[model samples]
Target: MAATAAVAVACGAPAEEPAPEAPHGYVAGAEETAEVQSRLVVADAAGAVRVLDLATEEVVEAGRVDGVGSVTGDGRHAYLASDDGSVRIVDSGSWTVDHGDHTHYYRAAVREVGSVPGADPVAVHADQAVTALALADGTVALLDRARLDEGAVVELATIPRTPHRGPAVPYEGHVLASVAEPGQQFGSGVAVHDRAGAPVATIDEPCPALEGAAVTRRGVVFGCADGALLVSGSDGAFAGEKIPYPQAVTADERVREFRHRPGSALLTARAGEAGIWALDVTARTWTRHDTGPVAAVNSAGAGTALLTLTADGVLHALDPASGAELAATPLLTAPVAPGVRIEVDTSRAYVNDPAAGVIHEIDYADALRVARTFDLGGTPSRMVETGR
Candidate 1:
């Protein structure tokens, strides 16, 4: 990792300076060879950040962050939301850059970056090399991705808070944040703000009791008890359009959280004791589906299918558009601990079976079959695939 390499360099002579230039983003192409290393970056109860490589089926104790129990990350960096008022950022050093015919990859020495202070950095969203943190106190902050890599940060904007728990999702030129009326205790709507923390519109649309939020290729979507608010556009101006749920999704049955991936406009959520709820962000439509008492759900292949891991240990893949069941396969028989999560990408879906200290990689396209089981060692309550 980067920390080890740093200590070794200190015992050697001063580093030599070299010239570099790449047409794309940071780390220049000439300096970035095909050294791509992707893995499942996890934060555990032991304050440790572990990396599991699927190819080698080996676990690497990357590093540790005190008080880190869960994590979220893009392919380049993993952001740990501490219970305290600060956020810890770790460079996963696993990323890919497309160069037309070939994709250039690099394996950076993973290291800890600077921390962002807040009332509680509940969520961190990264895009186009920019990072935005939403705090439990309703503080929304914008930061420079380059500065984060340098173990420092450039605060571009600090959207004032009103003491709420939610996320500030970043887009091309703007951010979407949950809005709370003054003197109110919780968030009741969603609003768009400029990079300077100015409101893009005069009015904030109601989304009382916002629970789940996701950033898709098209825009941002926030789950609400009533329905959902889909924010589109960018720059200093944006629009929040309501995507009301159908009559079938009554107050007794609504998803509080949603999960989605890049390129896909569909978001999957657990419809509280009911089943799965698919929200099409682009079309702003809702599709009713069931995963049979699922513990977790996720989307893959640009919203082609929805994957879920039932509480009964069965994995199911459903077509996202029509809510049709595509495949089903039993992967486990043990009862989950309310922490099992399902994650999917273009091809496969990965399930973390912490009780067995293993991860089930399912072939979703074929028939939701267990392709391989990786003995990751230790209990990983949650995990995110940091490999592209």
Candidate 2:
């Protein structure tokens, strides 16, 4: 990988003042790093938030929140939703900026920015200009992303509709949100809207019972009753295509939430207690790997083993191509707690054991080797990694 290109000067020429280094991928209060500066934003049931540095293993307090119902992250900031209908934003201080061919890593001081009245927020999505918070009441608040970076919670616009069950996705200067038909309780399809919250166009393909949504390199995906819907936009024109399951899937065994590395097309999710679901967005295919009683599932991307944690507290690495168990290791002694997750990066995968107050790090490529175990003092009920 090329970094910091050097310009040659003639041997006999007088040395000219070096041009000021360009401020490429620069953030106001962040320091660019030579390598990925990954950190975990972990929160306990009692609302205590902590930041664990992966490189130095140093844990630091990042303030506290209360009544946290759910937690989500956007590669940099952690969004914590409280039961009292509010959301708190915490800057993880580590992030990556990908320029297709090259990437840059940065680290800053972690802190809690502020809170917003979200009315029981379910998800948060962010892009360069907008940060959308989708609430359970079907109200989507579009916040200014630039203001959010400076510790402000400014809502630029609000899109109110019938109560739906998915996020209002920000994409290509527009927003893609789930839509519900009259008398329907859940979302039936997705619609595209301009930045001003005006409906622009609706995806022709119907996405019944939309439950989950994720942003990938190919486009934005929404989980439907029968299958998944992939939507992409270009120059204000949007289109959708359905990717149905290879076989019949019961409602209880459908893949809802998706997990994967940022910008990766390989999406993984628990397919009930039967197995794990892997969706290849680029190829428009879905593969189900039988991983019985899984607690969590994730993948680094294509060509990586599927990292799965079974309910019995065992971490198993399965070959994605054939669904064959390649390796396994027991990482926890206590019963696996609710909300356990397997966060995967290029080299390592992390699983939090709330009952044991520890997090296991596995080198996925090395036969699922246990590279490190972090004994956090408190229960990590919710955790998300930044700086991929």
Candidate 3:
């Protein structure tokens, strides 16, 4: 953890100086004091996870896991799903491994039993059980969180062969999953499962490949190929509304990622030529904001979104409701050649420059200003904030 430093220049300085270049590696103790503290966890391309303190702008802790995938947090514990068939847990408070030995803090080993090839863990249910899909073997398995340290995950249930990638949202009491063929133009479907992990219903329609899925307070929203969006209710009934993209948009122009702002009625993302689109489920309308080639998008509190540009490494905070630019800051002075991934909380944002193996902290309250930076030993792929 590094302490903050205030750079000074004479008011009557004769010449203007260029901003300092971002340092590389783990530069410790550079902390920032802000009104609110937000945590950002980021994974670099090399599959390592780093936990950052947004308010202090410091790299509190760092850990490496193989094949890191999706990250989810309950505002207390940060869960990292790995492709090595395990889930790693971290106490967000101390930025240390959760379980024990700091090494095996929160680890659950899930073996591929019954001839089914192992799949990367996707979504964690509301109750914390994890859902994973075996694409090659066409199997879906649910693992209980309580039995994580027993060297084997307690298998909850399984679904037969289906082509789908899932964060399978667990809504009300049922878990939802999707199935779609990559090359197929249409004809995809979703499945609903009871709390016991038994299939209750299946929905098949002309949906594109599922890109992102989220369970909102109101309903379930799933992103599809060809800019098709679907919403379902808690009763496993369709909402009778399909949000179709503009006629100019094609299947090739599909949404890659989505993040639902807590307590918001809108979902924001980087969509095709439409750039950052704000889809209002309540209003049943879509508004696009022109953000040039968005490299990453993250939630910035309720009804707000953070968009990052790959070319310049500039971050823009937007109002999800009106698509307005709330604040902007330059995280990286130069272009992040390999690109960077961002993780945001209501109070702060963390930017990972993998090329430099450094994590930059930006203070959201100060209009996304660079608060501090950290250098880590290994490249980070994803990050989450766990409050211990």
Candidate 2: lDDT over CA atoms? 0.85
Ten-residue stretch with the least lDDT total in model 2: 1-10
TM-score of candidate 2 relative to the true fold: 0.92
Following a full C-alpha superposition, what root-mean-square deviation does model 1 have from the true structure? 9.0
> Each model's TM-score, in the order given?
0.83, 0.92, 0.68
Tens digits of lDDT, candidate 3, 278-386 = 6676766666666656777766544445455545667787766665788887666465644355656555556776666677777766777787777765665455554
Report the C-alpha lDDT of model 2 over 119-145, residue by residue, as the tens digit. 587678888788888888888898888
Evaluated at residue 304, the lDDT of candidate 1 is 64
| lDDT rank order | 2, 1, 3
Off by over 4 Å in 3: 1-63, 67-117, 121-137, 148-152, 181-187, 204-206, 226-230, 235-240, 301-306, 318-326, 337-339, 386-388
Candidate order, TM-score descending: 2, 1, 3
- Candidate 3's error at 111, in angstroms? 20
| Clash totals for all candidate models | 0, 0, 27
For TM-score, the strongest prediction is 2
Q: What's the CA error at residue 203 for candidate 1, in Å?
A: 5.3
Worst 10 residues of 1 by lDDT: 28-37
